[model samples]
Target: MVRRVVVVGIVLAVVLTPLMGWAQSKAVLPPIMPLRDIKPGMRGIGRTVIQGQKIEEFDIEIMGILQGGGDVIPVRHLILFRASGPVTDRSGGTAAGMSGSPLFINGKLIGALSAGYLWQPGKRELALGTPIEDMLTVLDLPNGTAQTPWPRTFAASEPFHIGRRAITRVVVTDTLAQAQRVDEAGLPGMTAFIPATFPVMVSGLSPRAMGFLRQALGAAQPLLQYDQEGATFVASPITGGSSVGILQVRGDVSYGGMCTVTLRVGDRLLICGHPWDQMGEVEYALTTSDIVTVVRTLQEPFKEGNLGDLIGKIDQDRGPAIRGVIGRMPRMLAVRVAVTDLDAGTRIEKGVQVVRRRDLAKTFAAAMALTAVDRARGQILGGGTASVKITLRAKGLPRVISRENVFYNSRDVALASLLDLPDALNFLLYNDLAPLDPVDMNIEISVTGKRQTAAIAETTVERREVAPGERLRVHMTLRPFQEQTVPSRVIEISIPRDFPRGPAVLVVGSAGRQVSLESAPEQGLAQLLQQEPQPSPAATLDGAIQLFEDYGKNTDILLQLIPFGLPPEGSEFVKFDVFAGEVVRTDWVVQGEIQIPILIR
Candidate 1:
């Protein structure tokens, strides 16, 4: 009796295994309406956010498909539709952020609204979409696909062309005579389409900061739109058809692009029927967005929105769609900046987190540094001086890298102050040795209206001749800005042993010139700091850190010992086999150079 009972239970377990698996698959994926079943004149309701967080419905009437009747359908697929309703009417067209708005016919999912006609003047009723079947293929696409395509703009002309090929000219008309003219122009009415785009929302940045960021990012389209007050931190409910964001930087200052959510299956979601930068296998912060209102214009209609709380991370960027998983956050680089305005006696502190990507880390880091200074002072341009200190902590590094410098500029002082920041960050994040994880970044800046600059007026040494390995005191005088006279100071310089017993020179100059004089041909200090090439992966991280340790500051008085003879032929600067240097840091931005003749005995 016991053996019979055990055998009966085993049979029951095998019978129910496939049933359980089928139930779970059905729960994760909703029924998809195939493209073949779809017909012209079929009307569907699309979901998207027009104002606030509420998801509203819009009317979509299918006009036709791009593929003509043939034995084999072409891979190029597009669903042409005419959208109308309160949402479309208010915006005068399909807004930019509605790229991923989902279209459902009779409660069956069809596709996402991805492209539209931008040349049409007012109330662009006709639009194009990507089929849902092709969008689902993005889930199986390979990771790390390719470089992000550069944004581009078309010139104003008849029949807009892209790369010598003119897209089908499309126009909507209310009168019969106007409709007849569109057909006479040999246009393929509603066959060709272009991907839609929207400006990334930005907050807490000045115009200069935005311009610098746009240039650095090489953005053809407007990269950042300044409208929101700041970024939000609290998570909000995200559903299909709600507005979403692909965030790069968040906190007091935020930067990201907004799109509509297409579909949600369990914790997974699909957004942007088109590619999001085409950076496959990405880890960008995913957040919900709050739409303010849609602005109607002849150029293109766009939705103005602000980025809200971090809800998930986008892990895939493919041709058809971008896929993300909710509740999982991407790795972020923490940044803290403190700025003080000496003239206004105001101090401001800002904290932000940036997405960590090799292509974007340096650009965003510099933008954050500039924005902090721009926000602290009412203005950062015009005659001023700034002192800055940067501290960086990263994995695989033994100690934190710290640097301090002072800068002065007659115009745009903030930009001048952070000139070296991008180079330093580039070296830290992109060294060829090994992958590094950035831990934290801290920046402190102080700005004043008075120009804090000084020029090296004169230099004198007690003895004209000095022996090798001997120490000598050099007298120096600095002429301060608008000052009649300033006292002289002394800096001690050491002569390295084993020096040739011949004519030698003592060069006293600012740090920038010192670097140029000491650097090798085709391997300047600036190039090395910007892009460091290691011998091999086996090279120690210390080798890279040593370069930063030997670098001089802008506020430093640099002394170098070199041969007094002429440089090698075809060389503009002197190069020495055995080099010795000393540096003294001061409060002012030091400028000018003085060369003193000396002899080695």
Candidate 2:
């Protein structure tokens, strides 16, 4: 009899298997349901809030369905009719923080607990819920296939317990039934639900700004590339005015943030114009976190749509055509190369050159030295030539003193003739440019000596042919002083017949001291004159006289000479006499002097 019973049971199970499979396949699952069906007297499951985790389920039911609708989508609301037990601890009825808890009815998804509207005082109101259907629609997942199904092995009872009461056995069928019943009554007001989480995208910003953000995020590599155009050759002004040449920007690597610059010619590059923003001149690096790249052609101006995307790799080399890169990796850099118009007769090409930052004044000094030599040669040769001199004064580098090949006629020389000149020898002496690189020196131009403070000055020298044994004489005059008696002096210098035509000093002396001299082909007479003494502020009469004498001894009086050439047959003599006035007061005195000289060779 037992064997017969077992056979019959097995046969029955086999017959029902196909039917059960068909039923399971045909059953379509509803995505969501309303919350109103949960009657105050009904029994259902609720979601228990967990810290740092998704909310779990609890036993609950709808008390009453709130009905309202407007132009917006209707929100089917349900009240947590009742709880099987204490729904929460100190947190308060799932507490004020328990909003967004996904509630389930029977075995199906129902709605999320929103908030409570107290109809009266004393009696606490139940929690209201927004239907899952409305939320899913707003999330653009109305079909409910956006995510995978919850694990069946996970205990639903754990989420739906009433204080130690594990009520995880709530079925989806019951949850949906309760929500559907609430919906039948009336939908709540038209209020769209905000999704718990979502993703978004944005664009459009300045390249500098974007590069800055990338650096802030601690990107490892450079996001943009920068290219350098070779130094541009600028012609000296010809229309009686100075013409500035193009200030070429060199290729350099920088991270996101402000970059500070000290321009060789700041005035020529407008801060607000193309290359830079409208920030005043500064020396330190400015903060710029955006990616900024050079674009060589219009077809490739932008690598990435946004600046923030590119930060590292800004210094990578692109084709010769592109000038900069501005963006993050994997994104192509937009190339931009702006060709500025060169002055009428100027041309530019690539060569070994250095960008001078602070040593320009030194360079100018070296150039001036060269110029003096050229002037001396010109005087002897009877004509001037175009020349260029460069001096590198910076320390740690070898002394660089270069003089361009002399151009006999300025008309035949092109501006390019001056390109690639070396730096000034004393250019590096100054650590930095003061007020714009102040240079203090006892400058001696031939026989004249003066203590001067200047920014920078350049000199060039050129040589021309002079008849053999012919003497070179230069005429020089002092620029008269408007306020003070010019502390100036001069000396005659003669070069030997075989001495190379380059920078050569004729004479050197201090103020007021007379240098008795004779003539020689290599050594010239140095005539140093003391200037007229001005009044002095001294306490006693004797002190005043002494002061005047001291001043006279220190002050220089310059002598102007004309028609520099070989000496003519005649007498050459220069004389000066001092005159003293009676002391007007015990502390003051007036003194003067006059110089009378005769020149003969």
lDDT of 1 by residue, 237-352 (tens): 55568667777777766766777778776667778777756667888887655666676666556666555556678888765678877777888888888889999999988877
In Å, residue 349's CA in model 2 sits off its true spot by 40
Model 1 root mean square deviation, Cα atoms = 12.6
- The per-residue C-alpha lDDT of model 1 at residue 556 equals 81
* TM-scores for candidates 1 onward, in order: 0.73, 0.20
Error of 1 at 420 (Å): 2.6
lDDT of each: 0.64, 0.24
The clash numbers for all candidates, in the given order, read: 0, 94
lDDT top scorer: 1
Cα displacement (angstroms), candidate 1, residue 109, comes to 2.4
- All-Cα superposition RMSD per candidate: 12.6, 33.1
Q: In angstroms, give how far residue 476 of model 2 lies from its true place.
A: 36
Task: Give me the displacement of residue 358 in model 1, in angstroms.
Answer: 3.9
For model 2 the local lDDT of residue 343 reads: 21
